[model samples]
Target: MRKILTLILMGVAVFSAGYFFDKYEKNTCRAGVAYSIGNVDQKFNVSEEQLIEVASKSESMWEKAVGRDMFHYDPKAKLAVNLIFDDRQQSAINETKSREKIAALEQSYEGSFKKHESLTDQYKEQAKLYDELLSAYNESLNSYNSLVNYWNNNGGAPDDIYNDLEQKKASLSGQFDNLEIKRNDLNSLAARVNDLGKQLANITSTHNSNVDHYNVQFSAPKRFDQGDFSQNTINIYQFSDINDLTLVMAHEMGHAFGLEHITSSASVMNALMEGQDRSNLAITADDLNAVKIKCGYK
Candidate 1:
């Protein structure tokens, strides 16, 4: 009986150890505390505390999904938007600000410059063709004139021969007229190039000014990761040009937690927000499933 009881106890101990190890291996991203990277821009509407608050809200989504804490607030964190406001812009734009005006102006100037560049090669080819046609027309005119003089000087020349020269002159004159009209069209296109150049310069100046304004309006967190898990930090930048500040914050936190952008518009991890279905600012079912697959549940 003693021998049988000893074996049973040993088997239970071994089973318990195996279960602990398996659970430990599966649990991920629970090691270190994350710190908030403080605000740099004083004028930013969202305070550092508020940034933390939003991040906490984002964390709740992931935590609920994984049944584990993915992030925590530490005073120290790394820093890591706006639209004419470039998509690259990180600071959030005020909702009251005119996104339409900025977007339209940016579109007009950027589109104009791109169109101008495309036309350069086309215009060069057209101008070269015009020159070639002009040369051919001049040659034909000179040749016709010489033939007419010859007929005038030599009145005995056949009437049929004179008729042929006149016909040739008329044909060349018609071609020259058509070529001149095409050349005038090209000239009009050339004038637009100069006008677009000025507009491009003006747009460039305006874009720089808007960028500078955003720089002053918001601040981003600093990022620091040096191989050590404890040292890994994601300082969330509080200011953004997008109205969905919480969504952006969640996206950044996702990066810190080794999550990637998803193609589904339903996910907060989408690469683009434009035309995306951002009905929920939290991690979707798919997103949670992916995280669980990667990080496992508690």
Candidate 2:
């Protein structure tokens, strides 16, 4: 009678364990870890089957560690494997728009340069004209002084010669005044050219900043996993290598299993891997321990 009672209790305990596992699997959607791959198929150059295969392999790593089918494929499951484009593409778009702005500024610069070039030529011509007029005035003044000396040394000077001297001097004085005005205009044109140069420098600086901003955005060479735990969705990006792709899926799926990143390099939950050490892709003893703890497995 004692042996029979022990056997009945053992059978009941085994049945209870099976029932609990079934309930746990159904409640957690572990039986069918339904997922959808995103439309970024072309961007990654991977087929749907390839992506699915990688995800399944990643899932199997965890499932094997727990010694059970923890997750299965379901098309309508809230869990998902999605390919996402990094902000680099948006940064590229921003850079393109910035270039367009610079292009427009360049167009404006061309116009300003042409205007400055024309002004430069005008300034040169005015300067040359001023020099010639000054020389002529000096020569005329010298001739006038000589004539006066001639009159002083000799006798009665012609009234016409003095009149001609005065008229020539007055004409030369007017020309000098006109040249001074042209010089002022040339200075103004030079100031405008300086301002245009400053504008071009500003545009060039802005273009450089846009490029620097893009580089900063894209420099990390890393991937991202986005999941809120509410939707069971995992969005991934920035990984191109097959091994890297598998690593991200496994890591995020581990999160779905309530596993956190451990400090050990032996575990896949190390936050980031260093090299082509595919060993990181597998579930380590520590990882299995974590799953056991999370799932309350003996």
Candidate 3:
């Protein structure tokens, strides 16, 4: 299978190199210089200075991986994100304010619980007083009503209206007391729950949707022997791929470019990965176009 695929890429490269010899005049990409062969919305050459910037970052990343107590692994299903680690950007945006707001709400609820406890205690204390006052008021109100009825039945008494009004006042006083008790009970539970906190938020809001590329070392050098719109995209296999190095880098770069894995074998953006899918290490037209679109190409 490998030999057959190699023959195909070499033949195509020979034909394309012979045809558009002008574009191949100067090669800027070096060993492991990552490139994408997709429908990239934006395409530009990285300056020599920028290339240096990219390459200088590898040393520190490799160091961290070596320093690990143990390589962290997911036991159930192992899938690690690829990246030669980059410098940690600490000056990124912070979300502590939002977390603080959430914590404030939690504190409010905790206070409510405390208030409920206090209210319960108060309610108990006032219950005895309320019962005594309410019972007395009711008994007085009943007596006053009886007197008014007797007065009305017998004849109009001098203090009939005044005494009746006093009985109604006493009844209202008891109602007021009951209302205060109920209000305290409801107020204690009026506050609500909120967010506890966001203590370990490493990624900030600006980078929320940023494309994360993993450290992808190709199984072999990648190359695209043919020329097309996709071929405009470049991948460096140090100019060597026992197989199609461009295709492999382009395909994997499609993943780094943040395109989802898909089913098209003819695509650079195929969901299939090495040791994971059925295909030679190469990018297809679909993979190129998908990335071009994501890169904001028209």
- Cα lDDT tens digits for candidate 3, 175-207: 767767755654543331111111112222212
lDDT of each: 0.63, 0.69, 0.40
Q: Model 1: what TM-score?
A: 0.44
Which ten contiguous residues of candidate 2 have the minimum total lDDT? 221-230
For lDDT, the strongest prediction is 2
lDDT of 2 by residue, 128-211 (tens): 876786687678778867877887688756889778777876886786687678668768877776776777677667766765
What lDDT does model 2 reach? 0.69
- Report how far residue 168 has shifted in candidate 3, in Å: 12
Give TM-scores for every candidate, taking all chains together and pairing residue i with residue i.
0.44, 0.44, 0.23
- Which candidate, 1 or 2, would have the higher lDDT against the true structure? 2
